[model samples]
Target: MDGARLDQFDRKILSLLQADGRLTNNDLSERVNLSPSQCSRRRQRLEDDGFIKGYRAVLDRDRLGFPLVNVISVTLATHNRDNAQRFADLVAKLPEVQEAHALTGEMDYILKVVTPDLKSLADFVNGVLLPHEAVQHVKTAIVLQTLKETSALPL
Candidate 1:
């Protein structure tokens, strides 16, 4: 598909699903003013078209004992696609790396990490990160407070 052409109904369905993905088909149908079967078909089409990737239950990080959040800036040894993809693949395997971005600036990539405490973060930087051949430098900023956190994407 070139791009997902979203209509009003698609937008509404997406808004409701982002808030609560576990909503029953009947309940969602009622909310969107569509019959259950029609709503199901639309939802299925959306999934197949790649608009709705997957439904998942949100988990509490604090309750899960992962209380620390850190934003890490990393500079790579090179700016080639192979080097970037290699770093990205390594980042994908690290559970603590929640988000990673390739940017057009001094740094190669920025990573948002979540761990239990400073000790774990130290271990990750020393044991896991510094040892990487592609990684040139890393700087970390510990989050004192979180102003906002949301997964909703504007339609």
Candidate 2:
């Protein structure tokens, strides 16, 4: 639903869900000052309208044996739909690629990658990304520190 259609309760529900997706209807209702049934219906409507996508647990990268995060800038070998599609398809199959976005700047695309170590990151860049036909230039920068990272939006 559009932002204009969301009332206070709806906004509260969205905010609460963003903070803790595992919150039960009883707990959510208590926080939002609504009955559990009303809360459940509102939540269902929110999900049906696509405001709330599927829920997932945020995993710890360090605990999962992935400690290195890298920002990679990729330039296509040729500027064409086929090349872009090939690159997209290649990244879609790679589990190390956390996020990828096509951009309008000097770089054709930017990727957020997580790896176990520097050697793994290098192997991915040299063996996988650079060897691809769609890729021309690849620049990578390791993240030294994460000052801020969040998935929640301001409602």
Candidate 3:
């Protein structure tokens, strides 16, 4: 469905779900002032229409033994389609790479990587990234503290 077609109920459902994906239909309905059946149908429709991609449990990286987080700027050797595709494919297979983005600035791509420790981060960058034929330059910045990090979107 088009975004413009989303009603207030739909927006509330999305907001509630984003805050807590594990909320049951009964609970969600109560919170949104809708019947359980209505809530369920609306949720299913939202999912079917691709508003809700999927659900996942958000994990604490530090508790999960991945305390180190680094943001890396990557510059490619060439700007050709083949090299970009190859880099994307390689990044997709890497478990340490939590996020990657193609940028508009000097760097070709930026990557958010997480690892258990400094040694592991070093190993990933030196062993995996530098050895790749597509990679020309890489600069990394370690995250000391996160003031605010969230996935919630304002409705």
Candidate 3, residues 65-115, lDDT tens digits: the string is 999989999999999999999999999999999999999989999999999
Q: What does candidate 2's lDDT look like per residue over 1-155, in tens digits?
A: 69899999999999999999999999999999999999999999999999998899999999999999999999999999999999999999999999999999899999999999999999999999999999999999999999987889989
Lowest summed-lDDT stretch of 10 residues in model 2? Answer: 146-155
Q: What tens-digit string does per-residue lDDT give for candidate 1 at 1-155?
A: 43456777778888899899987779888999988888888889889988889988888999999999999999998778888887888999999999999878888788999999999999999888878878989999999999999989976
Stretches of model 2 off by over 4 angstroms after superposition: none
Tell me the TM-score of each prediction against the true structure: 0.93, 0.98, 0.97
What is candidate 3's TM-score against the reference?
A: 0.97
Question: Once all C-alphas are superposed, what RMSD does model 1 give against the true structure?
Answer: 1.5
Question: Candidate 3 — worst ten consecutive residues by lDDT sum?
Answer: 146-155
Candidates by lDDT, descending order: 2, 3, 1
Of models 2 and 3, which has the larger lDDT?
Answer: 2
The best candidate in terms of lDDT = 2
